[model samples]
Target: MVTAISGFEPTSLSLVAELIGTAVFAASGASAAVGKRLDLFGVVVIGTLCALGGGAVRDILIDAKPLVLTDWRYPLVAVLASLVVFRFHPALSRMRPTMLVLDAAGLALFTVVGTLKGLDYGFAVYAACIVGVLSGIGGGILRDVLVQEIPAVLREDFYAMAAVIGAIIVSVGARWESQIGHWTLMLIAIATIFVVRMVAIRYRWQAPKPNI
Candidate 1:
């Protein structure tokens, strides 16, 4: 059973998760910018959006100012991560496994953060679930928009599904009043999403297209 650390002060685990998530998303955004041959400024803009978009949307929905706006560290982290990836593109590109792992970690951390924030705002379970899913995919969606491409959420992978599952787990766990259950649910949700995504990639899993 996962333990609930929702009310707990920022622990090393939470901090690490946040940093890792920011880094992974930033890298992904930077990679897209590079593919588009975007200038340095464009890279920074997209990377920063990818790192903070989800959380910002979640906060707005919950009637709070975005956390990234209040804390400068988040953008600093995103920019630093983007620079590191940009500096070592050749070596970093080879670390596909590491990138995927980091992406999964980020998805999990953000999903939980979104769900918890929604609950804090006194939203019902359904609303919380929506917020959680949005928080998980919001960054990627923004990244795609900046690139003028279709969003990943509407494409072949289980991206949004993973977030939905995670949100459901978090919502259910919260209802149980068991911190352990909550955390366990969160962990499971994250793991499930990671595994599903990896497997989908490995097997070329895709959703069916509409028959026009």
Candidate 2:
């Protein structure tokens, strides 16, 4: 079970999750830029896009101002990550799995955040869950499309589904928040998403597709 925290006190764990998600998503985007033979500026731009694009889309959909435009910290985190990757790309190349793991964590966190945000804005639980999935994958889709590649969520394993499940947990768990603490429920949901994604990556699991 999972739930959203109301009156959102910025918990240390939640802050860390946000930072990790921003940094690793930035790293992933930077890596994509490298794959496309992009220059340093391109890497930074792509990284920033991946870090903040999802949240931006989520905000827009919910009729909120884009956080990236209002929050310096969001882009700051992304810039720092982009700089690190730009300077250490050669070494970072060997850390692909670490990046993916971090991305999984980010996905989980964003799913929770997105769903909660939607609920806060008066969306129904299921709609908020859908928003959560969008918030988890929107940035990656933007990054990949910019790089001229298919969005990984559309082509691969449990990437999108993992986030969807996490969002669903958050949506449903709100009903049981009194029985299970909201924070605890949120943690459980995040863990479920991260584990599901990691397992899919480790086992090379892919969603079944049409043979045609």
Candidate 3:
């Protein structure tokens, strides 16, 4: 466990987290497609965008080849998740609470992963925080845009705020603790985001909306 964390190597835990995140994001995308009454292919397209678009954008900004293109496993996981949601959306629709939990988990993981990737590409801490927030929110933003809706982060609860806090913790924590285990860092980041988001959801918390 320490070795996996120390070297920032892929571990079973991280793999599972990544898979869960991919599935949740794909479900969100597929559900949006279903709401729009789009075809199967369209559902897949949206799912791909939701599950992989943020990472792709991050990689592009970092001047690296997108991981989704290089990683067959990533796209495979995405399409399979999209298909399952497409076929079983009726049953799945009843699982809104479960979906929210999964969404929170994904949001947490994405923020950490994005921040790490940004730092890896030589970004400053503040820039990496911004990248992390963008990566956490980008996929959903794209989905909302395609569906002709306002993005949730802009108008909704503390969605982006949670990402900001988690990412900031990650950047600062790593810098403060040179020996901090990567897995430990990742876990801290995930827990921070999930706790903030869940609490916000439970309390109906909202950022102040300015009257135009």
Candidate 4:
């Protein structure tokens, strides 16, 4: 049975976190589509897909209804985000550095939420890890598909690896009984992913390509 986390009502913190993540994800997708000169409808589609794709897939895999569908706020958050990107196209165009940082933050936050949700559903740790990684990369994959490019997750950057690292930290932290362990692990994971991503971008770090 699906059980909700108690005492963590969908208060301001949770709502704000979700909104921020959704907006960044949507902005990234819309920005990519706009760069390709896709139609307005196409841009919106990409934006919505990027915002909800990950959560949708995770929900299905976990045998639960997507939160995006159950809660109207998610779509609203996505649409609003897309509009912001669309309206400020020129300014956003030059914010590549800012966009990368936002993406990293979204990746870290989503990974932890996915892992925790999986555990709440009584899934095994291995399954939780898979769900976490999928939730982190699913949106980007959908974005690439809409733009007709190879998904960034499959590229040489540490996209999925960063998510996995974050998920592992959360999972391991939950195993220990330290009182603030969960939050500490989450902060650490987010920081690690952000720092690692920035450094990788700076140094052009990449996974080894096949020698075939």
Candidate 5:
């Protein structure tokens, strides 16, 4: 019921973003499973876990209903995404760059959605930023753990850092919500996060390692 001046409904927007992010992440998970030569059931499991894990963690932290549990559409979308990937994995596997793009898009969408949800739940900016980062990376961590791979957040790649920056952008921009519409801020945060992540990928950015 929270409607903004631009006729933007925060809850509705969040729902849409969450579903899209879920699908994107699900596809990524399915694709990964396919690459690893997992069976169909394993592909579905990984996809579902990647799609819902982050939102579930965020909801639990905020004491809100987990969308993956309460909303049927979420799991359905995830499953459908997984099935589609499984069916056409040959083409998908060939498009590694495309998958990377989708992953970045998923991260951006989830980060913004998480940060906004935190604000909706009355969290302060900094705390909400942390929640946002958690929301962005939780699913990927679960996916990686299941596949016996190191979580992207803990890797030398710039994945978690990109999410952290995106979360901060959303949280800080939210402070000026009146001056700039929340929807506008949401779009800005998503774009910023996506760009940062893509740029990092292109540049082969690496987290600093020990000099030992």
Candidate 6:
């Protein structure tokens, strides 16, 4: 009796969103590696870690096989994206704004996708929300840690908060699917996360810190 929102299928929107998120995260990771002057092999390794680390960890927590292990397409997409970024990163590095935008998009998509998948696996709404946040931030954490940098989620950019809010929207929406339609709820969540993160960036918003 673990019914998810109607039409939230792996073969549909969720799958497409995950794939796109993977690509963007991979590109971001590859770009970071290139910035650090890593060789192509290191770049691809980091890209794959950034792309698959989150979903892989999520699936493991849910006691399911990671998608990257089962699906050929997932790693393939990550590698291709890394290669693309590696090839054009000089131009891309110059476009910091564009990279930030894509990073936000990936975060939003992964938040929604992870929430949906957690629900599909019969997690309670609250747990599903946590999974969503993990999915949104895990890649960046792995990427940053590998490069010996602080993870973006630990920074003062409202990054993880945005993911938390988006995950809550999706979790609540799942319960209210009849009232708001699944697709509409998901789109709203994505837009809300994107807007919140972008605005935080624009305003230099930060969570209150100890006055020490």
The clash numbers for all candidates, in the given order, read 5, 0, 0, 0, 0, 0
How does residue 26 of candidate 3 score in lDDT? 91
Off by over 4 Å in 1: 1-10, 179-181
TM-score of 6: 0.91
Residue-level lDDT of model 4, residues 105-184, one tens digit each, is 88888887888788778888788888988888899898998798999789868777878887877766666625654556
- Model 6's alpha-carbon lDDT is 0.87
Candidate 1 structure quality by residue, lDDT tens digits, 49-98: 99899899999889888989897878899998877766776788889788
List the candidate 3 regions with Cα displacement exceeding 4 Å. Answer: 1-10
| 122: Cα error in model 4, Å | 0.8
Q: Rate the local accuracy (lDDT) of all candidates.
A: 0.81, 0.88, 0.87, 0.81, 0.86, 0.87
Write the residue-wise lDDT of candidate 2 on 1-212 in tens digits: 13344776766767777988999999999888988889989999999999999999999999999989987888999989998998999999998777788888899999888888887788889999988898989999999999998898899777998998899998888777788887878789899999999999889888899999
Measured on C-alpha atoms, candidate 3 has an lDDT of 0.87
Task: Please list all clashing residue pairs in model 6, or write none if there are none.
Answer: none
TM-scores of the models, in the given order?
Answer: 0.89, 0.93, 0.93, 0.91, 0.91, 0.91
**Candidate 5 or 2, higher lDDT:** 2
Candidate 4 has an lDDT of: 0.81
Error of 1 at 4 (Å): 8.0
lDDT of 6 by residue, 1-212 (tens): 22354545645656787788889899999988998999999999999999999888889888888989899989999999999998998887788898788889999988888888898889999999998889889988999999989886797669999999999998988888767876788889999999999998899888777789
- Residue pairs with colliding backbones in model 5 are none
lDDT of 6 at 181: 77
Ranking by lDDT: 2, 6, 3, 5, 4, 1
